[model samples]
Target: MAKRRKMNYASPSTNKIPVIFSIAVILIGLLVVMSSLKKFTHTPDQGAIEENVQMKNEEFINRLVPVAKELHQAHGILPSIIIGQAILESDWGSSELSAKYNNLFGIKSFSPNDDSIKLKTKEFKDGKWIEINANFKVYASWEDCMRDHTLLFVNGVDWDPYLYQGVLLASDYKTAANALQAAGYATDPDYASKIISVIEKNELYQYDK
Candidate 1:
C-alpha cells in the first residue's frame, strides 16, 4: 500500500496581492505622465508670446495710419514720430486720458476755456516718480487732439521754427526722437529710447515716405 501525500494550496487573497500591487503601480505611473503632459501644454513659449504682442501693436498702428497721414499733411511733423509718440504716451490710444478725453499727447491744460478732465498721473520729479492730480485738456474729436499735438511742436500761427525748433528741425524719425528728449518732451530719462524702440520695432519710418 502506497501512502498518499497531502496537497496544500495557497489562499486566493494572497495570490491576488501581486496582481493588485502591479495595478496600483501602473495607475500611479499613468497619473504622473498625465500631469507632465498637462504642464507642457499650458506653458507659453516666450517667442510666441512676444510675436503676439508685436502683431497687436502692428494692428493698432495700421488703424491709426489715416489720422497720422492727415496730421503729416497739416503739419510738417513726420507721421512716424507722431504715431510713435502717441503709442508711447497713450498706450496705443487705450489710456484713460485717450479713452475718456481724447487727450493723446498727455498735454496739460493751460487754456481755461478748453474742456478738461482731472485725472491722477505720474510725473518724474526730484529724481523720483510722483503721483499728482492734473488737469488734462479734452478734445471733441481725435483730429482735434492730433491738431493740438501739432500746435505744440510748431506753436503760434506763424509756424515759427524758434518755438519748438528741436522738433521741427528734425530731419528724420531718429533725429526727431532724439530731439524730443533734448527738448524735455517727457520727464522720463529714457523717453527718447522708448519712442525709438517703438518706431524701430514697427518699422514706422516707412510711414515717413
Candidate 2:
C-alpha cells in the first residue's frame, strides 16, 4: 500500500486575512463618511447671511436719514446721491474703514499734509479689481466725514481743482449719478446704475426735497 502524504496545515495568519480585510473596509467607510461631513460643515448659510446684511442696511439708513438731511440742507449736495454713495462705499456704514475711520466716500489722500489712515483697499482698475494699501482721510466723527465729502465737491482736491465740476452742476439725482460716473467718482463701469438703483429702491429722493 502507498503511504498517504501528510497534508500541510494552513498557518494561523492566513486564517486572519478575512478579519483584516473587514477592518480595512470599515476604516475606509469611516474616512469617506468623515470627508462628506467636513464638506457639509464648511458650506455657508447664504440666506442667513443675506438676511443679516439686510437688517443692518435698514438700521444704517434709519440712523443716517436725519444726519444726511441736515448735512444736505447745509451743503446743497444731493441727499439721494450722498446716501447712495454712503451705502455703496461704506456697505451701509458697516465696513471697517467707515466704522473705524468714518471714511464713507473712499476718498484717498492727495497730499502729504493730509492726516490719513492707511488701510488695504480694492480698486476697479484697468478692467479688473486690484488690491492696494491707500492713505484715506480720517475724521473725528461721521458728521465730519459728511461735511468733508460735501466740501470735496465744492473745493475739489488740491491736485485737481476742476475734478468735481460735473457733479456739482447736475440738476437732479439721476443727472448727478451720471455726472459722477463721468467725473470718475468710482471706477466701476456700472457705478451710475448702482447708485441710481440704491436711490430709487429706498425712496432716497424724498430726502433730497
Candidate 3:
C-alpha cells in the first residue's frame, strides 16, 4: 500500500483563535448597539427645551388674541395691553391662580362671600418682595375672567370710578402699560416695564389692529 500523505490538522490553540475572534466581533457589535441606545435615550438639550417653551408661549398668545381683540372693540383698552398683562400675570395661563381658578388678572376678592380661593402671592413692599396669602377671585371660564378684567378697567374700583380711565385713553401699548403702573394695578414697581417687554418681545401689537 502507498504511504498516505501526512494530514495537516489545526492545533487546539490555533482553533481557539477563530473562536476568540468571533467572540471579540460579537462583543464589538454589542458595544456598538449599547452606544446607539445611549444616543437614542439622551434628554433634549437646552436649545430644544427653549424651543418647546417658545412654541407653547406662542400657542398661548394665539389663543388669547381673538378674545383680546373683541375686548378691545367693546372697550378702549389696547389689545396689546390686555394680552401682555395676561401673559405676565398668569404666566401664560400656567399659574395655579389662573389655571385652576381662571383669575387671569390676579383680581382679589375683599368679601368672604365672594367666589374665591386663598393663595400665596408676592408683593413688592418697602423695596423688598414679600409673600402673603390673599383671596383671589374665581371665574366660570377664561372668557369670564377676561370679561371681568375688561370691566375692571372700565368700571374701576369702589374708591375711584375713573382709576383706569387713563389706561383706556392710551393710544399706544406703551402709554397704556405706564398707565396701569400709574393707577397702581400691581404692587411691583417695574410692572409697566415688564408688560411692555412682553408685548414687544412677542409682537403683540399686531393684534391691536
In model 2, where do residues sit more than 4 Å from their true spots? Answer: 1-55
- The 10 consecutive residues of candidate 2 with the worst lDDT sum are 68-77
Query: 1-209, model 2: which lDDT tens digit per residue?
Result: 99999999989999899999999999999999999999878655999888888788788777777877876676667888888999989988878889998888887887799878899988899889999898999878777887788788888767798788777667689999998898788888999999999999988898887
What lDDT tens digits, residue by residue, belong to model 3 across residues 5-92?
Answer: 9999999999999999999999999999999999879789999999999999989888888888898999988989988999999999
- Supply the global lDDT for candidate 2: 0.85
What TM-score does each of the candidates earn? 0.71, 0.70, 0.82
> lDDT value for candidate 3?
0.93
Highest lDDT against the true fold, candidate: 3
Q: Which candidate tops TM-score?
A: 3
> 120 in model 2: Cα distance from truth in Å?
1.8
List the global CA lDDT of all models. Answer: 0.84, 0.85, 0.93
Q: Give the number of colliding residue pairs in candidate 1.
A: 0
Better of 1 and 3 by TM-score: 3
* Shift in Å, residue 97, candidate 1: 0.8
